[model samples]
Target: MNNLGRNLALWVSIIVMLLLLVDVFQPGNTQHAAQQLAYSDFITDVDTGRVRSVVMQNQNVSGTLTDGTAFETFAPQDPSLVSRLTGKGVEVVAKPLDQEGSPLLRYFLNALPIILMVGIWLFMMRQMQGGGGRGAMGFGKSRAKMLTEKQGRVTFEDVAGIDEAKGELQEIVDFLKDPQKFTRLGGKIPKGVLLVGPPGTGKTLLARAIAGEANVPFFTISGSDFVEMFVGVGASRVRDMFEQGKKAAPCIIFIDEIDAVGRHRGAGLGGGNDEREQTLNQMLVEMDGFESNEGVILIAATNRPDVLDPALLRPGRFDRQVVVSNPDVGGREKILRVHMRKVPLASDVDPRIIARGTPGFSGADLANLVNEAALAAARLGKRTVSMREFEDAKDKVLMGAERRSLVMNEEEKKRTAYHEAGHAITAVLVPESEPIHKATIIPRGRALGMVMRLPEGDRLSMSKKNCIAHLVVAMGGRVAEEVVYGKDNICNGAMGDIQMATRVARSMVTEWGMSDKVGMIAYANDDQGGGGMFFGGAAKNFSEHTAMEIDSEIKRLIDEAYDQARNYLHDHVDELHRLAEALLEYETLSGEDIRQIMRGQPIERVEVDETTPVNRRSSVPQVSGPEIVQPGDKPENDKDEGGEVHPVPQPG
Candidate 1:
């Protein structure tokens, strides 16, 4: 389409240039050769009867001589001169020069300026009205790209994952190919298919795949396209779009992000009758209205199905809602392989390993992962993307980039080194905690130091033991800081760790039904919950004593985890010092490195007193990287608009 647009502009420019050339570059070869005789010379020739068939207009005269040579001369405007020439036996005519010869070219030249000015005026008006550009359709029209059957060659084979979604849409292709096959069984094709999925799940890609399978016309538009400031413009465009779709029967119209337009009515306090609702109403009617079965299927995609208007999802409107979810383990491997096919990868690069690392990554996310790996390799001037670059890309995606330029004093470095070492040791010591991948004092995102962990595999439901173990691991930083440097000497670098640990303890007591004192009772507002009860959901119909019991249980759980971590670190004080010294020397340590160092010293479980003394320490803030508390946990790194985490913020 872009090529077609360029070609159209080129042709228009060529035509415009040709018109200007004809007007400005006409040759005057014959005019220069014609004799330019004065009025007296012309009269003399007329009196001698040598001039024949003379024509004159406004002092411009041309005549044929007796010698058969055509000559031109200037004559004073004299009405009687023509009669005198006729009396002298010279054939004469009194007419405008253009009328006596070719007048069409003169008329065209006169009209050209007016035409050009009108064309320019119209072009300026179009530009002002935002009607695409000059010679484009009106602004009120749909901006959908009309793709032919041949244009979209991205078939189901080109796409990967979302097997269920593909299966749901495959029937639409069969219906379009031969509607009789379904109608014979009274299956009358579905009027619309709403693709519901999370962002980056390849909803739009699947729509194109359907188009490719159908081998029919495809009209691709965004939901935002159906919104306009003018009240009726949106409805007009919706009508026009449906009309076009009906005309091109056996076609697929895919509207990406349909929730933008089809949001529930009366959602905003701004008023009921708004442009978007009216447009959505019209779209609803057009979908299941009269002549709905014109061999046209509407495919709409949105990550937010819960927010869409119920009317739009009714039985006849969007008859089917296909949930396009993130790919599973095998599915993710397949998706990675599909994306890796185009890029040159080293022999050591394994898609299965990458798929295993990325548990909840959507198809689009996996594609970006592959692309990022390739770009990383290219930036390093490598011929092929190796597993090393892929690993770096994955880390860069999950955690922010390493802030190598961040300078830290010896004391602060020592604190950060110990903080990360505490986390690494706790993770290895905790019974059900995930294995630590790497530990580093290298600043990443808002973190001063971090201990990264990779889950053994995907876990849907985390056991109570694992959740509590995570709580102990999260509190390890604060516990180690308090034991090594006194309690007051523990800076707020362990702030993220504290918050994660507290949340898990609170969840275990309030929602997970694991607390002995609050046994089998949920104090949370909603299921799987971490929300205040005041806003909405189930009423907290419990007594004040029950609430106090919940709070006490939460505090008791956190204190227990804290005590466990403190005891573990106190017992392995020498090993913890060794790990921290390693971090201080190398600025980083792998899981294997921590394991190797601890292998020399056997771990001894120890119990410690809860009361610890606080020693005065500087209040300088040190940011640290987030760690996954469990298999399905996400880090606290802030994501930018492009979904990538920004650079590690400067430590305060």
Candidate 2:
């Protein structure tokens, strides 16, 4: 009704403006059209008896001439004008001064500017108010968007790989569906459920699934939406949001990235953000304060749960914190199948094999991988996505897209081949090292070449021997370069390899306590854990002597790996030459190709799909050698590590 009234007023004002414009611009009727005459001409005509009749109002005069022509003129102060006209046999009438023109039209003309100014001011005010409470003045309103049924519904079936999280949230669905079941036994549904995990682990997806299963209103918002630039706005928004939640009882409220507003109070060098702190305080009060919010379940998600305020995670607030970590082999296979349903796949496209190759992929990453494969098939104008397309997609995702356009000279190509051949041979011979999946002298991203190794399956832990094998594989490129081109010709291509080996060795001595000389103690600082950056800074817990011992152990570990790599390359010099030569000729070799070359058997490169070319050589030139990609055991460099690796049993 308010909108109707406003629109009606707007239309009426527009019509009125149109009428006024027409009144001002309308052409006069032919009979009433009068020629404007000068005062002197009018007087001359009156003196000559040419005037027929005159109507006078103040100093303005209009009349019809003897010839029946109408005319109007402004007369000067002539006191005898009317008497003279009567004496000259001219018919005369007088009009009052106030009757000079249409009174309403004159009054409207005087007030037009004022009226237009007022209208514009009112329009601006209405715009600022946003009519429906969504403008500058509506900052206090909550931004939570209610997800209606019209918006695509996502159920538990759509979500895969995080079954444990789904199971944990199932009770909430049950509570919303039949609250009396738990209430009859004097049990109240949990106040809130906190979904905590790394990013892209299906936390938000789980929340939506719960809402879909329960068949209730779902109000979704982000933590940053609650706090704004204005003071007291966040608190007001919190109150508004809860009021909305209360009205939509039996509904679920999902807040993504809640750490934005729920950080620990009074935590900063300068001081805590008063607005954010107040918002957090208001949220805490509403969750478990004097009044209860019945039938309203609040679900929040954050990857950084440690930074949240304790008040927000108490029993009455977010009573349960469900961890949604990355999926295992079975879960990954399920996730892949779920994503694969959207793409047409060939009979040989096995989800299990793809899952095994992708060790640390999240649900989002799996979906992306499937999409990339489908796109690759489309690029080739193929009817269906095949296993070969999936393999190329995986390589593209792990390493970058193949730079077949990057041309390389013969010498540089040979050097890159030998560098990668070093890694492939060391990984194949080392009993504890993982198997080399593929080796390519083709430039990818910033690296001239890369050797990719895949674990047999998911790796849950690493052993002492496995760490040593990783160090040796990391040093293999440098060792091969030194052996083939001599120490004097060794290039800066080993920078990445050296960094990887050093990090692994340092972790072994400092964090994993794998060093005998450094003793079985964790000398590394936990700077990233609990209260990160805000309160985690402190001096080294160990003394100078212990630090020295740790440094010495790290150096000793790397030096041993380097010597081991050199000796192994020296022993298998002939095999190294064979693999390098094959790489130079073929450009890229899969696990089977590498195995065949190492066993002194010739390989037949057969085309799986004639539509898409395989193992194309680079036509563009590159100036550098190959670099090795290492797998980091720590979370900091998890994604860069690409995939996981574990010890593979040696063949008898």
Candidate 3:
């Protein structure tokens, strides 16, 4: 029954029961106003002819007196009592004495509490079981959901940017389609396939594509689904899930984020989790144990394959491990095409150009880029998404949304303008440094102004010259401020630059072995074990004296870069002033504009909106610019720091 019906029935039954209980306890009319009399007094009244009428039912006797009074009494078991009442001309009535009461009613009243208790217990059990026969108290049942053909069907065609991983899984699809072909050659399909990669790389999507191509049943679940607070529940669930897979042979069972339960056994703090370990053990047995699961394929995905137990990744279990890395330039272009199919694009929108602009982006990130562009176009009441919108969206994703409402005084604005101009000029002059793409004093995210520099193409590794050039470019902003506003007048806008420079210098000294004094020795700590402060961190790999050398080398690198940057700015002081003035006038300058200003030519500015500054002849014409660096009130030394304008951190 529905909940409302069940509740109504229960309330009705309870009301009946309460009434029955009240009736059984108080067996007479509560509203009666009758006085009690002694047996002798009742006899005297009947004998004196004062009794008007009498009614008797077993031991209870009630009657009215002749003087207009009402009374009730119990008489002794005497035969003459009735005869005396008749001789005195008194009316007498007798009712059948239900001696043992109703046997059925009495039985019902006696067993009501036990009956209600049993009914409530059964109801609770049904609720805990999720009102399904397969749900055994809801804890031991498999939470894996069966994905049917009609429900959000995804095929290999829908997946892109991970062709190698897709090709590896295609064999599984073939095996499921025609198992006899593989069997004829005495080939056994992989029992389990583990997809290892960073998040948003489309591991789970690949699994769904496998199911779609094979046209087989897909049962999807999560690793955490197998675990619960209660001990042994996870194991039972594992067993049940495999049993379900067995019932639907030639099916794909996807467990996303398997590392949750498949982490190395007994390697955590306070011993370990008994429930999770037990669950993992049961899963291992089900995968490649004595009972062969021939037609069922297990697919699991996790970013942290390092922490997974060795047993889980052995030859028998997870026979194939596919690495789904970030898409390269070609793959990214293909991925952009896949996501672009759903959006309305203008004539100017070029997927290839957009792909080239976004480096280190995953499939999910590309999808979000397209969505953000569509949203921006829609917000502007445009019919289709344009290249300009795509560029704006990319900027928003990389840097952050613009904070145009922010207010800054003239002094701070001029300081920010010079600081960013310093970064742009240095980057342009340095041979190995990347070309300056844009420079701006407009606020974005947390920065007050920034100068953005984009590489000519994708760079896999950096040379020693390139590294030193980066350090010089990092210190340019601080040097510019110092030269323009005196030694003590420089603000704290270079903190981010300093931090970035220091990290690069330390890595060069300790990790990359670029320091001559360190002599090509590796002293960096390995974080693959996932150890940190809570895990007591890793021990120092190098001795105390070696560590001192490393710190001294890092400081030396920074000092040299700062001096070099200061010299460059001092020599080209006129170009720096011109760029800073152009930024202050236009509020933003593209690469072409910066070049025009450097050559003593006026830039043709086209204002598209309140916040966007467009250069018609620019090579890159989007609203994309540099990171915003806030000029802090604090004073610092003649060194650089950092801000959001450096390298963008790719979101997973």
Taking the tens digit of each residue's C-alpha lDDT, what string does model 1 give over 1-652? 7647886887688667756655555565325477777778888888888887787776788888998878888876687986788798877677754545465676467557766876787787676545644243455666678877564388999888788889988989998888899898878888899998889888888998888887888999998877856687678888888877877887888999998899999978885459898898889888877655478789999989988988998998899999988787778878998998878766556676667667678888788889999898889897777666776787777776767898888898888878777878888998787777667787776787777766665565667777777778777888778878898786877777666666677777777788888998767654434443543335564667887888898888888888999989999988889998888887766566678777765322222221222211212111111222223323334321111111111111
lDDT tens string, model 2, 188-277?
Answer: 999999999888889998898888889999999999888766678789988999999999998999999999999999887663499899
In model 2, the Cα lDDT at residue 146 comes to 94
**Best candidate, lDDT:** 3
Greater-TM-score candidate between 1 and 2: 2
Number of residue pairs clashing in candidate 2, backbone atoms closer than 3 angstroms, sequence gap of 3 or more or interchain: 6
* TM value for model 3: 0.78
TM-score of structure candidate 2? 0.78
lDDT of 1: 0.74
**What TM-score would each prediction reach against the true structure?**
0.72, 0.78, 0.78
Superposed Cα deviation of residue 43, candidate 1 (Å)? 27
How much lDDT does each candidate structure score?
0.74, 0.78, 0.79
Candidate 2 residue 492 C-alpha distance from true site, Å: 1.4
Record all residue pairs in model 1 with backbone atoms less than 3 Å apart, i.e. clashing.
Answer: 445-648, 447-623, 447-624, 447-625, 448-623, 448-624, 488-614
Error of 1 at 47 (Å): 35
